[model samples]
Target: MITNLIKTFIELFGDSNEEICTFFAPGRVNLIGEHTDYNGGHVLPCALEIGTYALVRKTANPFIRFYSKNFPETGIITVSYDDLSYQEQHGWANYPKGIIAAFQQLCPIETGLDILYYGTIPNGAGLSSSASIELVTAVMLNELFAQHIDMLELVKMSQKVENEYVGVNCGIMDQFAVGMGKRNHAMLLNCQTLEYRYLPVSMNDCSIVIANTNKKRGLADSAYNERRAACEAALAKLQKHINIASLGDLTSEQLEEYKHLLSPLEQKRARHAVTENERTLEAAAALEKGDLARFGELMKQSHISLRDDYEVTGTELDTLVEAAWKHEGTIGARMTGAGFGGCTVNIVKDESIPSFIEQVGKEYAGKIGYEASFYVVKIGDGAREIAEAKEMSV
Candidate 1:
């Protein structure tokens, strides 16, 4: 893959006098702590080995050229530094464009560049693919331009691009995990304070498997924004009676006391946010004590809240989780991400992974009428420039 990416870069832009740099930014999966980031709660997420790869070089011309192997039909997109506005036709390129636009706010970009991108993440599967591309672009700019932007700042900038530029009201967890992930570890992050600690993921004799429903979600078209609005309305109702800023700040007892303050539907929304926050904290503690059972239990509880309380998980996700629960050697299974229809993260005994996949695949297809994809993922490091090779002068 690396060789092909480098070769593709040369083929697209020809030999350059300057050195070409290769950078990688990984996609992220939230092991637990769903829908809690926006509520100022704790989240557990780790970077995955699959993500986006970029080969970049500075060009003499004042025009930016972007190409992607994933979207061959779009061809090479050409834009100037002066014209950084979003265009619907740009498609996947907008992710990188938003990152560049954010960087332009900090410093002047004198020279344009040529970049080739390739991503391994399944699109619209609720994995942090957009964040992967954004962080990759940020890392490339920081190195090539010697900007020296802090990693946390890059994370923030990436989130800003997604929120203000790309127009998704997502929380900081995705960008944070992708920007600061450590190998063999998951981050326990406080979305409000941005305080974080890495917990070693010692899943002895087990593997983390992701089951994709293959049902794509367009954020704008999905009920994601509606759910966020529901939470906001719930919070506002609670604020009038109690002194709480977000549902994350409330305990189960406190929420119960203020239960009458919100509508029945709003009550369910707030309950998921509050309880999921608590579950995430407890799950971290269980992992610290090497209690996989307790951790697994918390994962199950999370899915229930998402399904019953938050009402995000559709039939496809519910079917997958229900099927996973019945399988032997399964520790736990739950829907991850925003959860209209995406993937479920499950911890299963290493020996049972094959049977688990086979059985779940068969059942899901029989019921849902489409095939599902499965991946066994490993936790990996955050974004960084990996290789720098001097181009042979022609």
Candidate 2:
């Protein structure tokens, strides 16, 4: 894939071999936590082996050119550094454009760039593809221009690009996991405080299988913002009676005690946030204790909360999880993202992955009238340039 991308880059724009640089940024999957980041709750997310790649070179002109293999119909998008505003016609390039716009605020980009992007992540599958692209752009710029921005600062800038530029109110978990991921490990992040620690992921005989429902979701167009609003309203109601900054600050018991303060919908939203936060912490501990069963049970509980309280899991996602539950080799399965429709992260015995995929895929297609995709992914390192490799061969 790297060689092909490099070849494509040369084909698109005449390349100066020495000036070319390659970078990768991985997509993230939240193991347990869902819709908890903006609520100031905990999230356990790990970077997937699949993500976005960029082959870029500095250009003499102020005009930036972009291309993506995944969206060939869009052709090459050209924009000037002076005009980095979002352009609907540019399609997915807006993600990188948003990052460029945000980065320019901190420091001037004296030179324009020609970039070729290719992503392995399934777009709109609740994997952090947008964030993956954003971080890749940030890291590419940081390396190419010698901008010595800290990684954490770059993570924040990526989030800012999504929130302020792209107009999607996202939390730091996606960007943080993509930027700071370590191999074979998951990050336990405090969304409110930004305090995090890496927990080793010892799946042993089990594998992390991501099953895509193939139901695309546009976060901004979905009920994602509404959910955030509901949580905010619930927090406001709780604040009237108790002193708490966010839903994360309260224990499950505390939330139950104050349940009467909020409307029924708001109460359910708050309960998911509070309980999911607690579950995330416990899940981390369970992993540390090498208790996969406990962790799997927490994953099941998370799906129920998301379905009943959060209401993000629709029929497609529920079908996949339900099918997974009926499989004997499956340890746990749950919708991993903001939910309306995306992928479910499942822990299954390595030997049973084939049967698990066949059975689940059959069940899902039978119910949904469409096929779903499955990937057995590995935990990988964060975004960085490839110094030794000339091309990326996915």
What are the Cα lDDT values of the candidates? 0.92, 0.92
lDDT of 2 by residue, 266-320 (tens): 9999999999999999999999999999999999999999999999999999999
> lDDT tens string, model 1, 129-227?
999999999999998889998999999999999999999999999999999999999999999889999999999899899999999888757788888
**Distance from true position, residue 344, model 1, in Å?**
0.5
TM of each candidate vs. truth:
0.97, 0.98
Which stretches of candidate 1 lie above 4 Å from their native place? Answer: 388-394
In model 1, what are the clashing residue pairs, if there are any? none
The alpha-carbon lDDT assigned to residue 218 of candidate 2 equals 96
RMSD of 2: 1.7
